[model samples]
Target: MSSPEHDHVATDLLAALAMGDDPAELGLDADARDHLASCPSCTDEVAALRETLELIAAGGGTTLTPPPPSVWEAVKAEIDRPAGAPAAAPAPVTSLASRRRGVPTWLATVAATVALAAGVGLGAWVVQPDEKDDATPQAQVLGEAPLASLDAAAEDRGAAVVRRADDHLVLHVEASDLGGPDGTREVWLINVDGKRMVSLGLLPVGEAGDFDFPERLLDQGYRIVDISFEPDDGNPVHSGTSLARGEIA
Candidate 1:
């Protein structure tokens, strides 16, 4: 029996060859090539992978219907069957061509597994509603706010953007030059009233972050984006150390 590593090398080389790649350009060692030439099992596996890739490529160019849920259930049952038990005959898959050459049982199983996965993915894509269907509205940019440093000497800067899709609203925050004391930095959605603020989450320095809040918050006048320097003193209240502030328009 071939070592697992050798099997993997041969499988990769065979896959490349099957995809119209030249054997010489694949950098396959002479010994591995010789083994592939001499080993019947390796030969069968390479052929099976080639056949599988061809079928998948053919599928990409056409609108093929996906296999039914029952087909997936049958595949799952076979995979879950206990070891040493006889495998019941597999159900016929619709698009698979009849075998051109005899392959070992293991090779057939591998090919079937590949085909089943491809079929499942294709089926999922087919069932997805088209984006242009209009029943699902595309996200719209509600507005943006440019963050400015509260201190005249600080270089802190960022922008806040609000977008809405259907009933959901998301806040996107990006920051730069946000230098502050050695404490955690957090995002916040402060109500225009200035007394009530909700902590969105932590913001790592020099990274962009997104926050999700209810549409009702915008309706309730929570349109300010504030990033504050906070000390880890087990307090949830805003620390009053604003690094940058902006009001969403």
Candidate 2:
């Protein structure tokens, strides 16, 4: 709260705490340690978090990936084709002159498309990053296991772990022989009621990132979480394959 630099320090400390690591050993220089000692809120948060992570580690190691906030409430959206819709309603092919009667000239449309392409190119050029930023992937990683697990999971198949916080859950997942792009992106969230499946973003991918669940969703009474590789091209249905799953005993 004091300074933007301190706030960045706080976030780094919190991330270390969330990962169940000793912040002192996380390459934090002297200034951060001094800042952490004086910051009571962060200290209290770290203390409580470490206890919960310890308990999670005490449980069986082999576990399933937990569901994210969007997993519950409803399944993936489906496009309902009309019950008796025709298989193919092909558009009538027409010559350029016939289409010219309907709207602006082809030259105008080409100019517009060229303008759009130039705009996109300029946007990308403006956002180019330095080496560190370039090294960081822009994609979201669904699980929160430490980087060590990620390095190991690269070669090992069927290794996934799930951990529970006081009001949220974290998943660590990895696999090799999974499935399709869209279907594989889908995952199943199995609770006592039934299955509230979810998509784990992508499969066989890891960067040791973490995801947080909504407190309200945890109160809804769903416990176990499982994920699968689902393709993202279209269909929003579960892949019916469980890459990894976990639940408390």
Tell me the whole-model lDDT of each prediction, alpha carbons only: 0.66, 0.40
Q: In candidate 2, where is summed lDDT lowest over 10 consecutive residues?
A: 119-128
Kindly list the per-residue Cα lDDT of model 2 for residues 75-135, writing each as its tens digit.
1211133455432322111112221222223322322222222221111111112344346
Off by over 4 Å in 2: 1-168, 174-188, 207-209
lDDT, residue 222, model 2: 48
Q: For this target, which candidate reaches the highest TM-score against the unseen true structure?
A: 1
**Model 1 stretches astray by more than 4 angstroms:** 1-138, 153-156
- The residue pairs in collision within model 1 are none
lDDT of 2 at 230: 52
lDDT of 1 by residue, 1-249 (tens): 344334433333444555566554565556556666776655665665565555655664434344666666656776787877755643222221231223344444534553343332122213222244355665799879888888776454979899995667898999877777888989999999988989889886565888888889988998999999999998998999988988999
